[model samples]
Target: MPYLLTGAQGQAGRRLLSYVVSLPLPNTDAQLLAAVLAIRAARGGVGNVTGTDLSTLRLEDARAAAAALRGLGWQIDGVLFDGDPTAAVAVTIPDLARETGHPLPVGEKLRSRVSGWVARTLTAKPVKKLPPAARLAGLFLAAHGTCDSAGQIPADLPEACRAALPDLLAKGFLAELSQDRYRLDEAVRHLSGVRPPTGGQATRPGAVPSSWPQFNADAWARWKSEATPALRRHVEAVEHCALCALPVDRVAQAFMVAPRPMVIAKATMGAYGKWKGLHPDRGSLAAEFTVAFRAEHGHGPSYYQLTSGLGWGLDRSLGAYVVTRLVKNEWLVTTGAVPWTLRPGPAAQAQGIALPKARTEAPGDVPAAV
Candidate 1:
């Protein structure tokens, strides 16, 4: 299967195209070519995407940039990020042998924190039906597309729209890929329900009430009351590794281990190619962590995420983050319910196993937007 790329007209898009073009295609390996195919496939996934307003970006300028890349043998496969599948978990690289194919290259916008409260809020049942934005904050850390770099969202929204998911979902503005997902669908912006926020409305941590933030200031105070005043709550926020600064060696391992089971995915610089999810115990994560430690300049350490970070749309706040352990065995990443893969054949998952698929949708169905 060819690589599928999505969001061809956003910040990462043009830059990615430019970078790929700069590379000498012929000398590239088969695996490299497969990665390109995966990117192309992502482009094909797009449908009724709400084109970013790009207030100052002239259409002609974009065309010129696109044309220049076209001259460089850059071929986009399909549309991706249909709505807001900010929850995608890995860099869909196919584990292809000489005979098999590879998966798409879906880079995640990594987040540093691991806690269980958030996952229950978004992925748990009885509440899985909650609106998409409830789980939106961390979308960027999960599966950011080209649009993420530009920070370009729909314009023409009211001044009060602190968060306007409803409006965007209405007029078929952005295709509703799934419950915890979204795709840009600007054609029906006017009909969208995402509205502006009103007076005194807080978008801060614990705003959702149903998820992790439920234990806001007062609750948080209660939980850590017994601990040292200074360390009342030190739910590891972020970390940096100095080893990454050195030239990387191929001897690398990835994993997920800790309080809970999570998909440990990180994009290391000069490390093992792209991102890899390592499971603890099941895998050699401790040593991997050591390597990660040695691979950095102790600055901008790779994001070692542990928590699943699912919940009501937002992934902001120190509490929302959870540290997790790497999986010790071979693992696969999924979206909603499917094992994200690069196999070109059928998407029909295993028989006894059923997963949620992105259903085509309209925006008005989204809560908060109205």
Candidate 2:
């Protein structure tokens, strides 16, 4: 309930669920649930799931649900049933990996929000103990409903889900249920997928305010015109990134500013002392993530983006420390103080990990390979 979606976010979430339901996989509620989670977590067509995620579903047969996913050509590595319950298992869904015609084409932050929404809605008090069919039905209805609580059953609602409608109504998850029409109860309107009206003004979620001082279009254009080919390519990558879609001013400012030396605080070092113990393979993991991240986004990730994408769950200070350590160890590299330029360092390259050919070929006097 704490994860309310903005107008754009709601639409993106609805599109994601709709895309998965429309796939040719089995229409069972269990498979539907698993697919939603997998697709939401996926980046570059790969996502990680754990035994705990499966067990929390309380499905009649978790293995069977996973098997059903595999039937649709999803490659799920590792044994979900036999492994350590907390170990992350990577699930690769080929369709999501495509650069073009991507079914769920949202940015990383939006995807994470939708994934969190699915988890929270499924586990809400009214539906957590419900059967898989009923729970899945709840998800569809909530996603299709509006801020006003009105919704029509989707045309593609699975046959099994249709039979579970009465259970949702009985459980108070639905305020009313007629043949093809239904309304979500007031208690769960936050989970509605319908975009709320913004009084006619459209808003981009992360856009910079117009008052920002550094956004000079003429200056940016002039800088690009004067920049070296390598630097120009790097600037374009940041400016044109589809995943970040950053404001022109924000992109311009980062490149316009001179690189600043990092000032490591005592607090950050203290946090790092405790944090490093939890991650034994931090160097390799950080290095590998940068490669995958650049392949999809066309630019390197910032410190926070790198840690979050890897599911390291570090706060800003600790994340900085970790990245600093990786840089020191030669497992990751950056372009001085440039934003979003974290890539594999020499150590990783020595281990057969490096940037794509196009990226590696263009190296300017930036003191790093992005």
Candidate 3:
């Protein structure tokens, strides 16, 4: 029977290959090999099969590879092997394709964000003023009063995450769980609380996270320290700008998913986001826009991002403030910068400014006003 093995490393896997190659008589353990290999695949990614251990994988594209393997008659095993104290290899199997084949498979390794919305809201809905992340952050300020939890989110995150907890709770953006874990609610997504970044931040734990890089401890910590409170202020401090009916400018800014905002460029174009200019009434008319479609439509729409276009160098007028909607609830793309440092209120105020007005859908499309 086939028996799968996994986690056996470089030299060790080669050694095992040698042993199996030299075995004069065939000893079948295909069942065992297949089970172990299957488990390893489920937990990890696609891997290279060599002797009795699995090594190097690209799990991102698993389905196609699985089909390939099934055609080869390999089942999986649920066992593991250790080459030594700090090293080891993994394995999988079904049965030998050939009773007598020379050598074994070698190893091959490989590896391998948001939006604009509003205006064409589809529905001629009445727009209401709302505070964005700034207000959310401000509420945090009111409760905490100061940036006490600087330097990092407490090592005991359950306790420290609380520092920014109140703001989320108040906004109804986050839900507290009976299991003691916290989760962002649908409302929490695209919240002004999240800050899109442009990379260059520390990439380690305890260092500031970069908007562009994947989320890490250091970046997350920096946000927990620097921006949590300010973000609160940014969100809460809003009043009016008829042109941009949202309560605050903070609400006007849509985050450009930080992790990888560029992918949407080729994927989604011609998507209109918010528009605006300096207006009377409020010093700056900034409003938030929504870009939503029925998820029931089968394949959901991808949010086109427009954040990086707004920075210092790449600050093409169209690129900067012109962002698209991101609906998938990507945390790193949205909030990578928020935990680190909030751009002071005055500064943030000037940032996400835009025009705001009710969407003009067809007459019949109008919903009964409350």
Off by over 4 Å in 1: 1-40, 43-58, 61-63, 71-73, 76-219, 225-326, 330-370
**Model 2 residue 190 CA deviation in Å:** 1.1
> How accurate locally, in lDDT, is each candidate?
0.24, 0.71, 0.24
Give the per-residue lDDT of model 2 (tens digit) for 1-370: 4436653455555566566677665656545545565555555788887888877788877667777777877887658678998998877888777543345545566678778888878898889898887888887887777756456798867788899999988888889999999999878877876643233222333233445476678988999999777778778987876445456776777788774666788988987888788666567667766766576557787786677655566677677778988999998988767778888888877876777664234434453355
Of 1 and 2, the candidate ranking higher by TM-score: 2
- Report the lDDT tens digits of candidate 1 across residue range 1-370: 1112211112122222233334433322211222233333332222121123111111224333333333444432222223233322222212211111111122222111111112322233322343333222222211222211212342221122215345444433345534444553433222111121123232112222222322245543344454333222111111111111111111011111112334333422212222222221212222222222221222111222211111112132221121111211212111111111111112112211112332433442211100
Model 3 regions lying over 4 Å from their true place: 1-313, 318-370
- Model 2's alpha-carbon lDDT is 0.71
Best by TM-score: 2
Could you give the candidate ranking by TM-score, starting with the highest? 2, 1, 3
lDDT score for candidate 1 against the true structure? 0.24
Clashing pairs in 2: none
- Tell how far residue 323 is off in model 3, in angstroms: 9.6
Model 2 residue runs over 4 Å out of place are 1-3, 198-370
Q: Rank the candidates by lDDT, best first.
A: 2, 3, 1
Answer with 2 or 3, whichever has the higher TM-score. Answer: 2
